[model samples]
Every structure is written in structure tokens, then in C-alpha cells.
Target: MDVQIVHEIFFMASLIFFGGMVGGAIAQKFELPDVVLYLLVGILLGPYGMNVLNVANGSLTVKLILTVGTSFILYLGGREVKIRVIKRVWVTIFLLSTIGVLISTFIVGYTSHLLLGIPFSIALLLGAIISPTDPATLVPIFKQYKIKKKVAQTVSSESAFNDAVGSVLFFTFLNVITSGHLSLEHSFVLFLKDTSFGIGIGLLIGIFGTVLISQSDYGFLKNFSPIMSIFVAITSYLVAESLGGSGFMASFVSGMVCGNKVYIGMKCNLENRKVQETVNETTGLILRMMIFIVLGTMIDFNIIFNHFWINLFIIFIFMFVARPLTIFTSTLPDGRADWHWNEMLFMCWVRETGVMPAALTGMLMGMNIPYLSHIVGIAFMTIIITLLVQATTTNIVADKLGLIDK
Candidate 1:
């Protein structure tokens, strides 16, 4: 609220703005993911390097900004999913989001416990927190590679839906670990309550928001549709959480409904028109630019070195083993046998993580939880490697495998 703080925020905003533009160009030239560039810029200008932005200690302003940005990013992620893909792959998505995620959590946790000497409970928490892939990176990479729709849908849908499941898993374990009395029965019941209620509320909000946009008489409202989506995402998340539901899930599902219903389907009469697609593409470009730039600026290099070898091992194994195993086994039964070996390999390594896991790490740390730093370290490292390495090379791999769309 201070004038000095306002000035600083503006200055940082401008810095991020320009930095994003330059980073984007660099990303395009180097065939890197724009998000990596954003994070790089953040690291350079943020307190970690040049000290141009002081969001290090977590100021209220910084938290608020990040929360808003993340909600919008998640909402936009939901907006990309269409109902058609949902119908065709609902079973796969459900299995992957719930059962697949649970399996990954257990595997990663047990592996960590054995290797890192952490308590079983804390290891499980770390596994749960890091299980779900971030859609921000997944979505872009899938689009870039021009993979088959079903394969893309599988990865994208899993990432979007599993975030909620992963979050629930994290909180469920946290409650059991922190609170005095939590039985498995209680945890199961809570999971049902949170998942169902979040979906219900998200559906209601999405329906209303879509209706409002569909029937609005004002011209200005159409121009500001992106802004309206921000509000819808926040309201859905908060309302779902207040009612003992998963805010993350609700926001995701609700945004999916709104996007497919209002933006991609019947309400979007102009969707097939060039202008509409252009606007949508522009919005995506600008958002991706800003998100990556800010992400880059938020990196703490100190965390990276502190957990270097251990974190690298986790990222490597997950990309090489954990994710591919999950996808290959889960998708095999669904008739994906025609996919080439290289195509299958490319599909295996599409993992990503972002703001949510990073923030959860800090929250756990504040609660005096052990292994919080390690989880955060892993989260940052995974994002860097996944987005920069996986995202950038996905297309090349796909091309080599002849999986690129003709």
C-alpha cells in the first residue's frame, strides 16, 4: 500500500513485460519453451540474481499477484479442453487422474523413502505434491508437436484433472500428519466430499458464466471475455474450498465447461470464423509470454544447487521411468498399440510442474514440515528440466518418430 511499494511493483512489472518479449524471441529462436525464458528472466532480475524484484521473502503483494496469476493460468488450461475429447477419453482420464496418480505417488514416495532416508509419511506427501504434471507446460508442448489428438488428449486431460487429485492427496496426507485424529476412513470420506462438491460448484459457476457471456447485450463485455474468465476461476475456486471441496478441481472443471460450452461449442457461433481464432490465438500467445517470464523471474538458484544431485536423479527417473510406465501401462488396454516405439517414448516424458507445487512447498515449510525444502527444490528443478528440455525437444522427437501431423 505504500507509494514506494507501488513504484516498485510498477517497475518490476515493466521489467517483466520487456523481459518477456525478449525471452519469447529467444525461446522461438532456440526452439525453447517460452516458460523457461520467463523463469530465466525472473531468476536474473528477481532477488536471486540482480535484485531488481524483491518477491523473495514472500510479501503479501507478491502472494496475491501469484495467486491471481495461477488461477487464471489454470482456468485457461481448462478452457483448452473440449467436451468431445472428454467423452471419448473420460475413462482414461479418470483412471489416470485418480488411480494413476495414486500409483505414482506411492512409487515415488517409496523410492524416496528408500533412497533419501525420509519418513514414510513425509515421503508420501512429497510424492503426492509432485505427482501431477503442470498443464501450462504440457498444453504447449502437445500443441507444438502436433501429436495425434488422442495422445495429446490423454496427456492434456490427465494433467488438467490430476492436479486436483494431487492437491487432494497432498492435503489429505497433511491433515493426517498434522492433525491429531485422522483415520483412513475419514480421509476417504473427505476425498469424496471434496471431489464431488468441487465439481458440482464448478459446474454451476461455469453454467452461469457461460450463460451470462452467451446472452450479454453489451459489446464491451465480449472484448473483455478474458478478464471475466479470471473472476469466474477465482469465485469457483474459493466457493468450492469454502464448502469443503477441492478448489483446484472445481476451478479446472468449471473452466472446462465454460470454454467448451460457451467458447468452443454452440454459443460460439463465430468460432469457425477467422477473427475469433485470431483473437484466441493472440490471447494465448500473450498469456504464455507473461506467465513464462514471471516464472523465470521467480526461480531461486540457491535452492537448485542445494539439492542438485538428488533432485536431478528424481527428475531424470520420473521422466524416463515413472511417467512412461504410467502412460504405457494405462494406455495399452485402451487400444493404443498402433503407436510407434519412438512415439510411445515421446509420450512417456511429458511431465511438468509450476506455481501450485512450489507454493505448497512453502506452505508445508511454514508448518514446520520436514522435506518441504527438498520438495520445492525438486519442483523447481523438474519445471526447469521438463519445460526447457522436454518441451523443446518433444517436437524433434515426434518428427524423428514420424508422429508429426501431416
Candidate 2:
């Protein structure tokens, strides 16, 4: 709004963007995950260090940048979800996204209370916020690690869908903690409503988007294809939000259907690696970089340090227990009974949670919701650690465990 803030926003955005490019290039050169370097850039500019870049209120500039960036990233993440692959591993995906999240939330929540002396409600909120892996930060390594098809599908499916599940649970729990009137009956009713409505909204959008593309002439639509998809994604999110459904799920489903839907006489033209699909992948790439950079600059390390141990414990559980249990259980149906322990281990620690939940947590905190800051701060810390630790060593771990092909 102010002239000074505008100048500051440009300056900060440029710095982060340039930093991300350098970090990304180096990470790729070294074969380390780029996400780790993005986060390292975040740490350098966050409150713990120079504090040159910060996420604050009263700025539409940052919000606009992040909103578009996040939407495009979510859509790209959604595009990665292949329905046919998921169908084979649907059982595993469902269990991990729903039950796995439930288990991790309770584990982290109860453990936080025991370990951090926090109230039960605060601990539970933290559990819900950081329960699911974020796909934006996972897909890069999914390609690098060359994990089995089933394992990769399961991880992507769960990551794509679990955000909606975790979000519903987070808000439901928040209602209970804030209002103190969340009965079992009320909770079940809310859960059913959220899940049903969210899925319905997403399905409807997916079907609509698919039909739109199918009926159009690709010959005439090439230039407009990207814009059309963006339109569909944004409208789906807004519609779902208006109806109190999960907009995140809606955007994802729309992209999923768009990615997999067959159009009459459409052909794959890989002449340009960036524009191979029916949708424009270049826009997706731009959005991904923008979102992660903006998100990186948003990290408030001071707040994280205030509650470092609590964050670490949550991260530990996710890395060592919840994710592994979900991946291993998901792989069971593939009939790969003789699992490579190292491959499984690499898959377990492959991905980390990221910007969406952090953004939601920040929103909740701004609303004066109790314990919101603690939950958000903890989630950010866990994301940073997960990206830095897991991304840096996933390849080494895979090789040491003899999972990599010679």
C-alpha cells in the first residue's frame, strides 16, 4: 500500500529470486535437492540472520505474488497425480492420507504435550498443521531417486490428497479447542460434511475441466490452453472456498483430470520440453520458483527458535515413523514382500511439508486464534529441517543402503 513497502517488496523479491536461481543451479549441479538450498537462502534472510525479507501483514503485493504462485504450484503438483497409477495403490493412498495423518497428528500432539509442556489443544493444532507431506517440495526428488512406480504413486497421491484431509481435521480441532463445545457427535458430523463436500466440489471441477478441454479444438486452443487451465484452477478454488469446501483439493483434482484426460486427436509434441503436455508447463515452472522463493523469505526463524525443540520432535516423528509406516504399508499391496530396506528408508524420508500449511497457519495466527503462532512456527521449522536434512542426504542414504543401481 505504501510507496516504501512497494520498493521494499521489489527489492526483497529480486534478492530472493536471484538467490533461488543460484541455489537451484548449484543444487542441481551437485545433484542435491534444490529445496534444501532454497531453505538455506530463507534462513540467511530470515529473522535469525539479516532479516532483510519478512512476511508481514497489510501488503497485497506479497499476497498476490504468493496466491498466484501457490495456485500454479498446487496445479503442477496435481498434474503429477496419475489416476490409473493411483487406482492400483488407492488403498494405500487412502490409508496414508487419512489414517496415516490421523495417527501422526495424535502421536505428535500427545508427544508435544509430554515433551514441550504445551497445552493439549496447542499440541493438537500443531499435529494437524504439519501432518501431511507437501508435494511441491517432493516431486524433484521423486524424479532423482527413481523410486518404484507404486511407491512414487502412493507418495504423490497421498501428498496431493492429504492436505485437504489434514486441513479439515485442523479446523475441526481448532473449533473444539477454541469453542470448548466440540462433542463427538458434532465432530463426526463436521468431518463427514467437510470430506464429502470437499470431494464433491473437487470432482465436479475435475469433470468440468476435463470436458472443457475435450470439447475444444486444440489446434485453436494452444495459446489459450494455459490460461484456460489457470482459469479453471482459480475458479475451482474460489468456488470451493465459497461453499466451505477444501479449495486445495479442488485445484488438485481439476489439474489431475486435466493431466490424464484424453482429448480427441491430441498428440504429444515434445519439441519443447517445457510445453509438452496439453497444459503449459512453463507457467508451472515460473510459479513453482516464485512460490518457493516467496515462501522461503517468509520464514521467521526467531519464532522458530523460540520453540525449536517442539518443532524438532514433530519433525523426528514424521521422518522416522509416520512417513515410513505409511510408505511401507502402502508398498505391501505391490507384492514386493522382499523390500529393500534402504529403498524403503529413502522413500520414507523423501519429502517434506511446505508453504501451504505454513500460509494457512499464518492466516490463523493473524486472526488472533490462540496457539496459532506456535503451530505455524513449529510447522515452518519442521519444513526447514526436513528439506535441509532429508534433501541433502536422500541420495547418500539410498546409495549406502544399496538401493541405487550400480
Candidate 3:
């Protein structure tokens, strides 16, 4: 890389960090999520708006930062999942992450294809891209509102796991579209293989990390446990991806195991707790700021203008019709989940598109897929609208439903 490019990257990073601090304060004052404000700032200063921070959409630096940021986000999300909570809501999380994603994907895909006259393949790709909820976006809202434990676990776990599912489905549909063929058996096998391997890699790494932490003899080693934890998280993700597994799933599982101290057979001590808190607070905040800003920079005004009505229509259907239908239908079966009516309704409205979809859309743009511009435009619009609408109103909805902690 050129020296000038390196300097520019650092300059941009400083700007993003500064902007995020200001945006977060403004959001808090207005009782809104910081993510919405961060995104708006990005759009305002990004190339499309003021060209103040002109990072190329397809640049290696952007992609590298996004990849690292996404991995850390998933790792932190996984760490948030407690074993007891998972045991309580495992069935619900499983159903919502898998069947629920499919339900939303097909409904949105088929409906959009019919309404917009786009090919079913392209519609499906779009649906898969946007199917998974983003924990990076939601975890903050959950924390800010101090949402109910059960509700938070369900949302966080589903978001973390379904991200892997959504990625698998996205690629599966992408293949079908590119090759002009669809095979259910083949797709299922691929999904199973990717998910299982990813989980397996994560378990292995998690166990190793737990044992390492447990055996640390020196105070220095104990203090270094947090750094070791981060190392394990990132390594698990990269190693799993290199082995044709879901890196997202691997990272999530690693964090979950390490966070719960499953291998060590103990609760996290104060130092360990501080490590987790500091890592989650600092890393998550920085990554989200960078990713959302880069996402804003990628937004093209012309495409949004050309497809304005269609974009609005798709967002409407996904948010209101498809998301609600998926939540109710998937969780309706007895013994599926422990959600009451209010909880279910809150969950239904909690679907905000975030990092995963934005990252995947960027990848899709690189693939030169059919309707690439439209897909990117729609995906970008969905992120903005969902963050603006759902994120902003999330606290109020929680309060109304009494899901917020007193």
C-alpha cells in the first residue's frame, strides 16, 4: 500500500471515531439508538454526500475492515449468550434461526418477484441477503433498554446463529442464479456441512481457550486472558472459513463457550468480566461506526431515485408483512418457543438489518450479479429505513410491552 493511502486510512479512522462519539451523545439525548445517528453522519460525510471521506466502495481497505469488524461483532454476540438462557430458549432460537429465516426469505423473494417483475433468482438473492437480523445493531438497543433476559437471549442468539444460516442460503441461491439450476438436496447438504463444521471448529477452539485460561498460573497470564480470548475468537473464525465452514458461526460459538466458561467449569472472575466488558464496549462501538459509515458511502443516490417506489414497497412488505408472518408462524407451534403474545409481537418488530446484510451486499456487488445496482440500492435503503424506523421506536415498543427492566 502507498504511504499516502495508509495515512488517509488513519485520517479516515480518526474522523469516524470522532463522529461516532458525537453521534452517540446526540442519539442518547434524543432517546434513539446511536446506530441511526452514526449512519446518518456517514451518509452526510461520505463520498455521495459531501465527499469529505472518499473511501472507494470496492477498496481493499474497506473490505478488510468490514471483514474484521464483522468477525468481532459475531464473537461479541456469541459471548453474550449464556448457557442457561440458551437451554431455556434453545428450541425457539433453533426454529427462528433456521425455519424463520427461510420463511422470511421465500415470502419476501416470491412477493417481491411478483410485484416488481424481477426474476425469482434475483429476488431470492435479495431475500437471503436481508434475511438475518444484525446483532451488532440490536445488542446496543437491548443494553440501552435493559430488555428482559429471555427476550434479549432469544434475539441475540437468533441473530448470531441465523447470520450463518443467511450466509449459506445467500450463497446457495447465488449459485442457483449463476448456474441456472436449483437442487434441494444439494443445498441442504451444503448447509448442513457448513453449519456443522463451523460449530465443530468453534467448540474445539472454545474448549482449548477455556482450558488455557483455567491453567494460567501467573497473575500476568490471568490479566492477559482477555487478549488471549480475542486471539481465539479471530483465529476460530479465520480457521473455520479456511476449512470451508461458516466463520460467523465459528466465531459465535467460540465466544459463547469462552463467555460461559464452560470448559473451565466456573463463573468468570472480575478481571475476566472486565475484559469481556471492555472488549465488547470498545471493539463493537468502533467497528459499527466504521462499517455503517462505509455502508453509507456505498449508497448511490441515482439508484435510490430510480427505484424509489419499489424500494419503499419492498421495505414495507419485509418489515410489516413478511417479518410478522415469519415470527408468528415459526413460533406458533406449541413447545417451539416460550414467547407470550407481547414477547412475540416485540420480537416481530425487532428485525433491523445491519452488518451482515451490508457486508454481503458489498460482496454481491463485486460478483457482478444481475440487478447488482438495484440490489445494493435496495439493501442500503433497507438498512437505513430499518435502523431509522425500528431502531428508533424499539425502546418505546419495549416499554409499552413492559419488556424493559424497571
Give the alpha-carbon lDDT of every model: 0.71, 0.68, 0.82
Give the per-residue Cα lDDT of candidate 2 at 7.
Answer: 90
Candidate 3 lDDT at 79 equals 79
Best model number under lDDT: 3
Q: Tens digits of per-residue lDDT for model 1 on 198-264?
A: 8899899887776655544533245445555767889998898898888877888877886787445
Residues 1-406 of candidate 3 have per-residue lDDT tens digits of 6898779988998888888889888988987888888888888888767788777766787778777788878888887778776787787788888888998899788877887777887898899999999988888888888999888888988888888779778877877778777778877777787788889999998777766666344233555676766787789988998998888778888888877884347444576768757866787788888888778777888887777897788889888888888787767773645579999999999999999998888776566677787778778888988888888898899889999988
Itemize residue pairs with steric clashes in candidate 3: none
Worst 10 residues of 1 by lDDT: 268-277
Measured against the true structure, the TM-scores of the candidates, in listed sequence, are 0.87, 0.85, 0.94
Model 3 clash count equals 0
Candidate 1: where are CA atoms >4 Å away? 180-182, 215-224, 262-266, 269-298, 336-342, 362-365
lDDT of 1: 0.71
Highest TM-score against the true fold, candidate? 3
lDDT (Cα) of model 3 = 0.82
